[model samples]
Target chain A: MKWQIISSDQALYFHSWDNECVVYNSLSGDTHLLNLTASQILLKLQQSPTEAITLAKLVPPTDQSESHAEHELQIEHLLAELNALNLIEKCQSTINYNPPSCR
Target chain B: MNISTLTLSELGHRLKKAGMFLQTGTFITHLKTSIPSVAEGIRLLYADYPLVEHLDFADFHVSLTYPRNLRRWLKPQIQFLFDGKPPFKPLPADQAFPMLEWGLNWCVSSHANHYLIIHAAVIEKGGYAAVLPAPPGSGKSTLCAALVNRGWRLLSDELALIHIGDGRIVPLPRPISLKNQSIDIIQSYEPDAVISRKISDTMKGTVAHMKPPANSIIRANETAHAGWVIFPKYQSSVPAQLKKLSRSRAFIRIADNAFNYSLLGIKGFETLTGLVDASQCYDFTYSSLENAIETFSALEPPASSK
Candidate 1:
């Protein structure tokens, strides 16, 4: 599935400092404090709707434990979290399947 | 003219009769009261504030009086009247003066939407203001008093009125309210500081007010640009440390602290973003005023911002 920012690109304002980002949603009049990973995902989604595997590429490795499989899983969880907050929404339906690493 | 120009008897007489239009910072208050403690509180603290002999309008027309009910004499409670209407329940007669101060603060915070008001203590030096946003018992007031007594100018002890258009801080220097042990600490910290009489057994136990510096009141027209936003927390036995905080975190904290952030909607968000752009954010912790002062004095903004 592909996820996209719920609001227009202009409605989501970004002010980033180092690794943290603060997004002010003009549509709902809410401000959110997000970590670098969440910020990058939102930024990517704002530009264009993208798949979980594509969003996973934005995350750089933090430690030896972070493999490609873990990065994809983390991105999927973040996308769901953002969708839950009404910050983003699912644009397209994909198969109800998981990667072989998780299965 | 100033309230000091009037004798104590004259001040009380004016308050009993037609209210005097007293100017503190940018707002004029038409204050009238039959309660002597409120009169004395104004006389003691607002001596240097400007007064208008005749005025057409006032931002707040407030008065304090004992209710006609049995509570007036049974327990002797005083009610704060905003335009002859009570906004809050009556307090003990002894707490009349504090009620007036609090009511005046409420007047500004509730109605004044021209600026994005934040619940913070503001101080200025070298053409820049440091905004200290903290919750109660965080020692922001104590730190603010110590800073002003040392050298910095007190912009305000409570509300920080950041103009929506220019993002400059409009000075609203009012008396600093000290609670619990802070009252005694300030007295010991500054020997010359004049504080009001302590009133006990109110909502905030054992409260006293330190008179704002006359110079701050006199220079109320001067405004300062945003420079730094520091969130200070008092920790016992902790070394004074100034840690760099992310601008995003500070942005959320300040918006949460703002009085009209939600009311102003999109404008508040834009104004806050501009503020965070210009200020460096920090989290400060200290137990000693002297050490805190040293740490603050050493703070430097970029040359470009100046």
Candidate 2:
């Protein structure tokens, strides 16, 4: 599945310190603190819509030893969390069901 | 002219008929009340504040008066009026003075959008201002009282008005409200402290307000740059300690305590971020007022004899 940021204006109000960012959502008049991973994911989505697997790869892994399966799982979790926050939404684009057997 | 120049009778007369305009830092309040206690509180506590005569505008026009009902005689209570409307329920008439203070706070916090008002106590020394943002029961008022009495200037006890454009703290120095046992603690700590008459059995337990130092009221117009943001907590029997807090955490804490952070929206975030960026942040806990005073005093450079 593909995902994209719900709004482009969010990037204009982004402020970060170390691994955390404080983003002010103008629509709701609410401020949210995002960790580095969540912030990076949003930053990536803000640039352009990307496949879920590709967005997962974009998130910098905290531990290099983590397996690809684990990394993919973590990205899926963050996407769900961001979706719940209304910061991101699933893109309307159709998924490519014909699998490339291996990357 | 300052309120001190007005005789008690004159103060009462002004309050009764024309409404006296009292200036505190940037805001001018037109206060009117027939209640004698409220008049006396103003005479004693706001004596040093200037009487803004012929002011073109007042930030708030407030009044305290008895209800026109049987309750006026039986268990009398006072209603706080802001522009002829009562925003809060009436309290026992004796609590009129505290009610005025609270009403003024509400007026500023609710109306003053140009400033990023934080629910904190601010004090200055040698040109550096320390912003102490803490929750109620944190002993912040006690510490602020001690500091101001010990030569530091009191900017404000309840509100720290940070300028949105320049980030300097605008002073709103007013009486410091001490609650419960802390009232006696401050009185005992500083034998010469001028505290208002204690009104017991109110919502905040027993409450008393300490008159702001005359010097603070005199120099109420002086704004100071943000220097430090200290979060102080009073824990009995613990050794006085000061620990450094990260700027990010301090930013969150300060934002949390701000009166209109959300109301100002993104501007509030930027202003708070700039404040934390420019100041050293700390979490201070102490069991003793003396220790707290000494530690804060040391933040200033050694004073030269005048």
Which of the numbered candidates is closest to the native, going by highest DockQ?
1
DockQ values of all predictions: 0.64, 0.42
The residue pairs found clashing in candidate 2 are none
lDDT of 2 by residue, B1-306 (tens): 789898899899999998989888899888888999988999999988887787779888999999887888888999999999999999998899999998999999999999999999999987778999999999999999889889999999999999999888899999998999888999999999999989999898999999999999888888887888999999989888889887767888888899999899878988888787678889999999888888886674323211
Question: Candidate 2 regions off by >4 Å?
Answer: A8-12, A94-103, B300-306
Q: Give the range of the ten consecutive residues with the poorest summed lDDT in model 1 chain A.
A: A94-103
Candidate 1 Cα misplacement greater than 4 A, ranges:
A7-9, A58-65, A92-103
TM-score of chain B of each: 0.98, 0.96
Candidate 1 CAPRI grade? medium
Worst 10 residues of 2 chain A by lDDT: A94-103
Error of 2 at B304 (Å): 25
